[model samples]
Target: MTGPALRPVSGVPQRWITVLGSGPLPGRPELVADADLVLGGRRNLDAAGVPADRALVLGPLAPALDAVAALAPASAPAPAPAPAPAPSDGASATTARVLVLASGDPGFFGIVRALAERFGPDALDVRPGTSSVAEAFARIGLPWDDAVVVSAHGRDPRTAFNACRSQRKTAVLTAPGAGPAEIGAALLAVPGIERRLVVATDLGTATERVEELTPAQAAARDWPGVQVVLCLAVADGAGGADGAVGPMRALAGPTEGPDGWALSEEAFEHRDSMVTKAEVRALALARLGPRLGTLVWDVGAGSGSVAIECARLGAAVVAVERTEDGVRRIRANARAHGVDVGVVHGSAPGALDGLPAPDAVFIGGGGADLPAVVTACAERALRTVVVTLAALDRVPDVRAALLAAGFTAEGVQLQAARLAPLPGGVSRLAAINPVFVLWGTRTAPGSIPVDSSATTAPSGDS
Candidate 1:
């Protein structure tokens, strides 16, 4: 009547499967046994504090059935093996007893779910222990409820990375490959990621420790058996851990203004070959609308003026140029303007590859391949494409390039008048040659038109 095994009313013979209770004491339903089957504590049942007459002890998980077999009397026939655990499908019988061995707590992301699925949810019995994640958080003395928890095992690391990058606090469950080092490497590559703090190599019986490390340093470190990693940062990480806020600088608009752009020519210190004339740049930037949060690319960035202007307007910008001399000028210009403009010492389209896709692109030099770059940007659906062409013949190529790239292309011819000395007594408007401003917004229909409108026409910078 107090047998450990249970045999339903209908089955082949009266054979049954035995389930064992874990770790400590009895009266905890000790073990379930059949006529000749033993579990939990068999020969040494009494030593383990269970009555041998009724208790059957199966050994560890690997040889559980073998332990029961050796303890049974040779003359007794073995009971039918518990129906090869029900199929994984939920349709399996709802009532069954199964054994599961777990370190710490099986309920904490361990074998509990597997047991529940095989035996049916209602039949699951649990033996709990401290969860790994819990131990990890405790080891670091950090509260976990407010933390975003993610598993990096076999899952794309981006989900966990984004959680840590965007949230103020996050706990990452690491796998062998996606551990502290991998996560650290990615965070290091992100701009401004240095302001965040990291906790790596937590949990496990040995080598358990916690400390602060910059993402760059952490990613470069070699770590072993680290179960969890944590990332925490203030929402505005512009000020580093020491809390020093840096100077403010803009490249495109008045150094200070809201929705600030439409910058004046005097705002830039150009002596002035590298400067894109203010009036011409105005129209180019309108079509481009290079603003913060988005990314813009400027190729043939003479002084890096346009790219810096874009960066100042709030968008991340990168300038590409081939001349080492031009490269130096661009960097100097970008620094003078106090805006962070990435400079690439290479040519267009090709140099743009491998970089993050951009929101807009400006081709200030690729006159021959201007159409090709525009076509590629349009195919990728960049938000905008602006090209400044000075040669009379280059205008047709620029217009055709924009049109071929899925833009409702529009253009303008600008000429500016400069004050010239008239016999040293008066000043006269000296006519500057015309420059072509051809651009298009590679946008969906109903979007704002690419503004190629200009105030004055001049050759130097119309």
Candidate 2:
């Protein structure tokens, strides 16, 4: 009367999951067809012909990962009696089989990291495809080993934009709201930026499209479904006179920052000794904290030494100089250093109005409008403001302005004596004019303490 004797079942069988790259399954269609559970984008699930009951479309990542974690087998099953090939089609009806589809080389800024973090690396059998960055660079026949690559997907695009501005070549992985138009607009805002934009859409598919355009041209259009963007600096004749590719590079990414900073005044073209002294500049550069993807304003930029140095350190610089000769000097110095510095031919406080909000500001020569310039710079600078002054009288006013603007102000008087050759084959310390270097760091939210002790000299005082 009893039904056919039931075979004894052991523990829940172990599941085997294959994480496949974008496009077709690459001769593994049976994996999708026979999978007890399938996870991918809507397009991937449809293309793979996965049944509705078995398919789980990826949307909010948490829920998808939760589902995957929930379905994991509780324990390992007994081993087969003899050696056998791992299941290619699917696991047995009692065991769960998972197939995950992802775009591009998922390991490269893709879903693989999430999978590995959630399920452990040993749980995944990954099959990767070409990344969008590689595909975009390939379309232009350029080697990307020297290019900076950044992802703007589901994150801030500023870093990518800054990389594009600072580096000669950069690849940006695009997402909604941070695609070609946005990137184009950001680059267009930088006056005298020389860059070409390549927009690639729907990579690795039949409808893939790629186009090269100027930043202005790219900004003017509404790019839909952009997958990748390449920002390239206009060739600077690194190629031969016949326009051949330049010699291969030994390194990758953007060129390294200057070998030395706070360069000697002799390295720059300055009027008389009006340039910020190298000793003072050394402290000023440290307080300014200039780096890639930041904008720094050098107010009253005489000789553009600080501006050029900032550019050398990978910041986008705007040098504001009142005198025509000063502006010319800034440009010449920036050129000599082989870096880009936007020179504004106007006085500060007034000139600072039109420039983009700076991450840091260095007020080297504000003169009579020193207080006003400090106020203006303090209001707009995102992180810190540094002011160098020869007259001690202006220190109090600068500190007041910075305190009013919610900054933690600190100051130092630097006086260094350089080695001067003596008549007897000896050296003497020749005193340099003392200068006051004042820096103000923007206070974090809900924490604004105006330290009155900032005016006091630190430990060693003359």
Candidate 3:
């Protein structure tokens, strides 16, 4: 301590690079003084008053990233001097100091991702600012906790559009082509969904503007540059102080469910008993795993019992039925249960073509084309494929189709008996028809068979 005045070892001098967020320039004097090369947008550098020789203008991301990588190594040379300014006294002029400037919380879906990909996380120190999404929501005085945030920046807008379709609250980060106008136009195309759009542009900057518009209004006007869009359900939103719509829908669709699942046949009004039995439906529903933000296909939906149950469990349902009476029954049962089910009046393997790909599929009636229907469902399904059969001869073929489609196929036969009242007031078992249920899940290639025994024919129907 007596030999030299002890001082705290500063981490800034050791850090070769800094990726700074652009807001009002931060007062990191030590870091700025040491920076030999400053890479940023021309506007950002100009706003910070950095000299042209020391500041490299960012153009395309890939090339700029390459330039940064070239200067990243410890042995790399320092940037050229700005005109004829003499080096600062008693400072390390030999060390290379690189600075990258990005907008608003560089870590939040910003330039940090690219830099991290090239240099790794430990290589750079990031000074974060407020994200555009956070700033956008603050401008309207709305909480963003329940809102689904999606980025359409350099990505297909389909996923963002889908989130808006299925969710009541959503915020989309806009890119060059995928901005407010494109999102608004897409929302208008959705049938029953009506969303009020709130567009916030260049937040935290002097020229910042926030506008509330209808889907049509946003689509009609030209919106350029960096922006954020909030899609709110008009029916559910409460009016905000800025005259913008507030989130009213309590986290998307219906929150309640029937007291229990695999409900009795009487719960739904059906012709005869064309519905899948309660016990069978319980097993099928377990395999399907129907939940929110997922779509399930009910191929050959019959009385729509399975479809209605799926919709009740919070999955979007599409019931495909060929006969007019069957389609009517499906709609009526859906209405009776107070759930939305898209009724497609057509046959399967054909009707499934236009419908969105499903997370799971339930095949209740495939007639003679059961194998073909199973094949089609297996190919399209993302998670599980379940099929019910009454014919003993078709079990092998159905199992084979599932296996061929790269699935871990399993089968179970359910036979149930209800307590019947005898004349003498004694209870007796009344046997219900035994039905074979076959289900398949997508398995990784080269994986061992999980249910090889399931493919074998059952011993007997008890």
lDDT scores of the candidates, listed in order = 0.55, 0.76, 0.72
All candidates: TM-score:
0.46, 0.83, 0.62
Each model's backbone clash number: 25, 0, 1
The sequence of per-residue lDDT tens digits that candidate 3 reaches over residues 316-415 is 6778888899988988897688666777888878877756567789999647889999999888887789999898899999999999999888998899
| Residue pairs with backbone atoms closer than 3 Å in model 2 (clashes) | none
Candidate 3 residue pairs in clash (backbone atoms < 3 Å): 236-248
As a whole number from 0 to 100, the lDDT of residue 275 in candidate 3 is: 87
Model 1 per-residue lDDT at 235: 33
Give the lowest summed-lDDT range of ten residues in model 1: 453-462
lDDT, candidate 2, 60-108, per-residue tens = 6777788788767675455444434445543332333777877777778
Model with the higher TM-score, candidate 1 or 2 = 2
